[model samples]
Target: MIACLRLFSALCLAALLAACASSPSSSLGELPRTPDATIEQLLEQATSAKTPEHAALLRLSAADMAFQQNNPARSAQILAQVPLDSLKPAAQIFASTLTAELAMGRNQPKAALAALSHPSLQNLKELPPEQQIRTGTVHARAYEADGQTLAAARERVAMAPLLTGDAAASNHEAIWSLIAAVPGEQLQASGNPVLDGWITLAQAIKNAGTLEQQQAAIDTWRAQNPAHPAAVQLPTPLTRLKELASQPLNKIALLLPQQGPLASVAKALREGFMAAHYQAQQAGQKPPVIEVYDSSRVSSLDEFYKKAQADGVQLVIGPLEKPLVKQLSARPQLPITTLALNYSEGDQAPAQLFQFGLAAEDEAREVSRRARADGLHRAAAMVPKGEWGERVLKAFRQDWEANGGTLIGVEYVDQPVALAQQIADLFKLRQSEGRAKSLQSTVGADVAAQPSRRQDIEFIFLAVTPQQAQQIKPTLNFQYAGDVPVYATSHVFSASGDKNQYNDMNGIMFCETPWLLNTTDPLRNQVTAQWPQANGSLGRLYAMGVDAYRLAPRLGQLKALPDTRIDGLSGNLGMSPSQRIERQMPWAKFVSGQIERLPDTPR
Candidate 1:
């Protein structure tokens, strides 16, 4: 089988070289022919081979060729013809591995596992190192297809030490991707010190914003696990971290409406930012100096920004209102980097400006994503009767449809009667009533009738306040639409810690920050103890402030690597190419008058 594979690879290289030479200057329509024809010719030659061993080798080669042609079914069919009993010991193992791979390609994980279950193929350590890694990779993939993420991750981890050079890098990347897909709680519970160490290192790298912090994390991991494989592979990520951490920014200026109608909100944000700063200080890390500026007292943003620049402020964070964010974003040339607290109205934002906020649109988009992930593809939206409701509904609809979900209906109403009427209309309850009325009129007085809700809608997207949600939820149950699951934004729940008030909201699911649901965290407990009065939107804003403080120095690194995510108090933060940072939050469901956190899943 090894000789046959080498021969096949040589033939492919020759064919590729010939094609490239023939099409050196060919036009779009005059390119060289595809290798499918060559593959077919080889298949015919394999069928007519004289020797049995040659025939088996030819069949295996044809199966590999078919796979290269992107025809897994054809490959499996070809592999089925290879006489496994006639091949040598090594050849038999290779043939079985190839068969299993082809079966996996066909999405038949059980068949793949069965192919690898032979006694001769069970002891992979006896095989060559490369073959062992290859076999282990296929097994891991099969496990993943079977929905066994931890098992799959462990399979890769077990093969890690044997990999070297480029293969080692590739294997490490694959392992990280697999582990990253696993939930944090599951990763922590994996009981494998190597996997746990990798997860911890990944989190530390994500949260680190400076070279010293990253080096300290790496050193700490090395100290804890001196012989671990990840300790040796730390240089790869550290190179990128050093590059990002090299950028200089020693001073930051915060602009907030400190003495106006929004003073309480500004105060909460200040406290949150300070909490993060203080935490860094406690960790023996010296962060940049932060100066607070009152936006309400400033005559103009231009003057304030110019003053900050003159004062040698390397970064500016703030202007909590939308108008101020818009005004600052419209500036042609900002002397210093500014992180706006709110997003501008238009899609295009100025350079040197990054927007971060507890935007309703962000939560609405997340609701749609979570709904689709939960297998709810068809949704009916119930929003309040106002601009805010319309905005949230629009965001949900756009994201839902973009993700291949069907928006069955959208209704906006504030009053309970209006909400009930909209729900009835959405579920076609009036049509059921009409049918019942017709049946009653046509039949005698002793007839009975039953009304049914629409079955097409899989879930509901609600954008309403806590009070409105309480009224709407019970009305949905009363209207015979209780079976359909309902998903909402964070607006449906208040952070007042009153479980009894939300008893009516049973079975409703929403997404929110860990700071609200995970009260056991030291930071959360401290924040709650410090500000007992913060609730609902104010609490969310405070959490956002904490994340903002942590994100400031890491923006450069985030832009450098778009796939990297920071676990924040607000949510999991990821950066977009357009400089928009999105938060992926934990999910929660209202059950028995109390909020319960849902298991985190891949987004």
Candidate 2:
């Protein structure tokens, strides 16, 4: 694990090297030109500097070198010694940018943004183009980390004129990535011609009917805006898209169990996949011919693949059972590209096998991301007492700690009768009561003292059922923890449309599928019109099924371009290295017996 982390850190430093242009020699101020100087030599020079400004410059250079060497701790230590308010404007900007970079390394994007906002940055343009590019790139990265996609794209767009050669080419690709990441609804005309042109180009490709039509749209966009930077040289993803257009998926086989414990699940998935297929047909786009195979009836996996290949199946989109997926994952290779509907336990997956699922782990990780984004660093958890809960807690802990959050307390929730005591124990309310008694005894009389829960807990990470959540929320209020924020997984919501039920869950924020939240989604509306149960908790499975269909043709697109995301009913979907599909869900809170969708940042 340590070796893997070292490899990851090395890759990260290599990626950031493009933005690490050398500091202008003029900022060094009479210091010997020792471009090859070690960190010790730089700090030694700083200690003997005659002027404070020169000392700050030396420290800044040392910090930059430390960061380049992947020693963020040493970089942060050196940066802390440089008194920013006492430094010259140029040195101040240099220090501030370096500070931002270090903060970002710590997963504190808000802190990074604050560092970059130093007043000294107003004179950034006066610095050399290298410094400007370095500063702008860091600023863009901070915005991206903070979930301000438009701001990040705009920053990159502003840096375009100042960039050239490999730097310019890289920034051009980055700008498109940031813009493409923006949801279709948020991709608006910013009224800046250059940014607006790029926005329109993304919208044109997104809204185009077919791959051929998308290629045509790109060609037309370039023709209409010949002066646009993207027109001069298309982003690499677009170049890949042009190649994908000629080789379309011609046929698909959806492998699922027709009769088993998961038959009902298979039904929902099939309906959802067909719903998307019919939608494409209705929209005048020619979707590939689809064949459904009942895996439960198949005697052999080899025979199944032999039939599929004989039938000219280019893509296989299921085997919703975990055991079946595990079987496929153990193979050296698959005869056809398979998008498994469920994920297996281990990381070893064949090159042709891609896993996608509606795993609760995704929601747990989403809670961590949202909680940290809300500035809640200290967390307590309440999850059901079972293996499912263990999995969720594991996912949350891994992501939460990795993002610099502290999980201070946890309670394995069991019976409803035990909830009040569990809540009290989690909040240290019993200790508070014990302290109150001690105070009364010391005073030798009755003293008025209200029990106070631990103030260290900033929020609660909750993973429970709808009924359990209904009981848990009011129990927390009874235990004096109602005021503390609660970040919950989607399990807490049943989509029952019961105002009284929702009122019980009031003040609890949860991540949920866009299908349940977006009442007006055309596909969702149509699907629910036919299968009303799609309006309930079952809707998430249906949404996952819809995403599976959307993912089938674009799997190659996603594999080739690692950053590509498909906004689907389930979530904002991306691919992991193991070919598992990861979802970033939208968040919503219960307010006044209604579910209120929230902005990416905390309210």
Candidate 3:
């Protein structure tokens, strides 16, 4: 009898041990219910499962819910014990994604970024376009948290092409491109605003009447707050900014100040506009009667519009000054389609007025996105002091944070600030933004964990012109560029100051439009071949002409039905179903003096 009791005790001990040895850490004993689940219940059930795979899957299921409930630490701990190899591809992706979220929640952005970059998570790309975008964003955020800004930024740039196919569909390309202009760590309880905006617009595209109406609809939704997208660059135009690339020409107005103080700038614009006008006639495109509105003659835009109405003009372009454009916003009920040119002054163009100019805000935002995407998180901008610096810095700060990055600081070349003050400010911005940890700490533990000496900083965005850029590029090489890639804005393209600026310009990347590409497209080829003989800004004018001509005859249709968007010479054009022109801004990199298209620009 004593021997029999001993055997029974042995059996009981063996059973307990076997349960603990089972796959998935908790074993089949009353596995605690996931934190959201009764942890006790889950532990019990999980242990009861015979294999680790089963137990891990159950844990994953529970963790997902927990995360949805916003308890990431618990979710992370629960997942830590599970080996996800036994799970299916979709399930594996989920597990990896959840792990990343947990890491992020723990304030270990680097860990989250690393987890998202894991080979196992690559399978997440197999998910739907929407899901890929959603998952990719989380992964990007993790990189941002880990101080891997460029990787996060690249994920965003790549996303625009992915979310919206190269071909224009209800202007998805433009919307995605705009949204991608901002990048950063993904902590949004909802989701990335750019992705959300495109998805919402994509869903509503079929039902909307015109691009104008669609934009108005988007704006209306945004006003309510709940449905607002999580993206910084709202596919503001939500449709193509071009209205006339494919249509017949009727009558188009050139709105530059053909007779003012800024006459040279206006003349540059006019020359380009007229060259495009002649090109249209030469291209067998129905030529629209080109009318010159001496913006100089009109004391105010209010009077200008009244005259425009009297002339039966179908399309209006320009107002080059900020004050003039701002006035139009108050009286936007013009009978024609207005494509107003943009300027630096503090002008808020009307919803109906499409403004096109290289505003500092746009340049800063573009540089931030590109640099961050390329994996350069540490950025030190050197700008002309005062308003320009302030303007660029404001955008840089906003966009840098939005992209999940911190500015290393700003170096003001402005005279009043004093050289010492500027230098002090520069180092101060760097130190304050946590550059200490970044410089001293390893870039990636996993990367370093491996036996390799490969260290590269993705891209650096320098917002300086040819002169300032020339002055600064050497310092970056000697003091900063150390194996780190550099990036710049269109201003970098400004002519050489004093000497061979382009020669001095090396190792910088920038963005531009389709016009710069050496494409086989007949229209592009024509411009490429003829540009040498024409004026300096000839190509830009041709683009304007092509776009304007397409829009001129269609003004009536555009105003009547504001939802329709189309392709144009510049790129895919759309309007926020609200009448504002939308554009898919493509970017390029400048190596030496030549600009090369990035791998992700829309075809």
Candidate 4:
């Protein structure tokens, strides 16, 4: 009777373990009531299995269950007990792949590669397409973990043809993201014809600006390599590419105030636009013939428009001053499509005119949106004392309140005392002091009093220069509101300031063009190399010029598909229904006297 009881207990344990290992879901939802108990039970059952094959299969199932429960170390331990060679070919592949994946999860890239080196796992094409793709993905991840980024990207690109539906879309996006991360100059021709073709195609697509150029590029590639496999699959991406490319703008007229207060800015823009033109020309593209018109030299925008029309210009890209832009917008019908450098004052702009500029109001609105996204609900603002500052503050308040955030307080400061008093009022520091005095009086003896700032304020929307920011940030901390976050526009970053000087402005977050923040970008480096004098204030204008030249041809696509965004040098360029080209810039925080880019936030 004692021996039979022991046998019954062993059978019950094996049955429970078998039931726990049967479910195959990737998540822990299918695990037994107690995962640890199930794993222990599985080990006991594996040791008492009837045959070696049964034991190996039981161990593999336990390893999978352990992994599902987020126990990678235990999973690896269970996998080690299994004799992979004793299993069937499919089972061996399964065990090896799972071990490799778990090893990768533990950041053991070498161990992962070792596990994947099994003979059964080699020659993945022998497996079904789905299995092959899965194994290839693991190999690609292993390569990435080992710091072989190009190798990883090439692995995915090689399998791009086999992916379909959501898999294909995700793979395509990953491939492009990796390729874009590598500088254009570093993309050399791989010895393989297929890879070389892909490299060449990627370069061509990068340079192509319009539908005609894209189609011509595809035709050229097809003619060069008629039998390549990519040619057969080219139509898939082409459909999406067609949505981004629009009709070509062969003749463009650039209008600027060449001899006025804005002449320096205009010069920077002209140089930047010409730089893009030269780049396209060098890439064997038939760039638009651009004509420069001095808005200051012409009597009115009408004369420039007529002149541009007579020259058969397909698009007009200027009128930099706001008043001039407003004048252009008031015209009954523009001779050609005009991309105004500045937006008009009214809500509605002319139908034929599209506006694109680095506007202060846009930056303010972006700052408010970012603050709200950061979970900051109550805001206080410190703005400069001027018309531009008023516009920025008003725009920020409107956007903040519209997004269900409250504007707790606002102050316009032109001096130190003004800023201090405004901050004190915003935080109700004086009220705290008055309350502390009243409590001391009620205590009927001289006592130490502790004042507290208002807890309602969550963030500060600061519109100030870098110089002002340096002085204001520390003052806010001294005033007992240091814990509250501070957000600002690109104005807080001079882009070429002394890094050490910005140490005082630490903890300030702002948004700026990737062109300024990512100084290592190939295009930015090239532009800086050519025009070493372009820095600080003019640098942003230069980026605007490069994007404007690229945007002229793609405007129709932006308008047609609201979801479309072109990755431009200035920022991610998109269009609003009001004909304003919106810029979505990257975010950065000043840390240790340097501007560091924040992790990308989802749109």
Return the top candidate by TM-score: 2
Candidate 4 stretches with Cα past 4 Å from truth are 1-247
Global lDDT of each candidate: 0.77, 0.88, 0.56, 0.77
Give the per-residue lDDT digits (tens) of candidate 2, residues 177-243: 8888776778888989999999999888778755677789999999999999999999988888888
Rank candidates by lDDT, best first. 2, 4, 1, 3
Task: Estimate TM-scores for all models.
Answer: 0.64, 0.67, 0.50, 0.61
Question: Against the true structure, what is every candidate's RMSD?
Answer: 10.2, 11.0, 15.7, 15.1
Candidate 4's residue-wise lDDT over 188-257, tens digit each? 8878666676667666655665566766776787788787655655634454556445455689999998
lDDT of 3 by residue, 342-437 (tens): 542444444456655545565577677666655667666667768877887787789788767866655667453254434434434344334445
Residue 510 CA displacement from its true place in model 3, Å = 2.3
Better of 1 and 3 by TM-score: 1
Write the residue-wise lDDT of candidate 1 on 424-536 in tens digits: 99999999989888887888564576779989999999878889888888989999998789888888888766777678899999988877877777776677788875445
lDDT of 1: 0.77
- TM-score, candidate 4, is 0.61
Clashing pairs in 2: none
Q: How many residue pairs clash in model 3?
A: 65
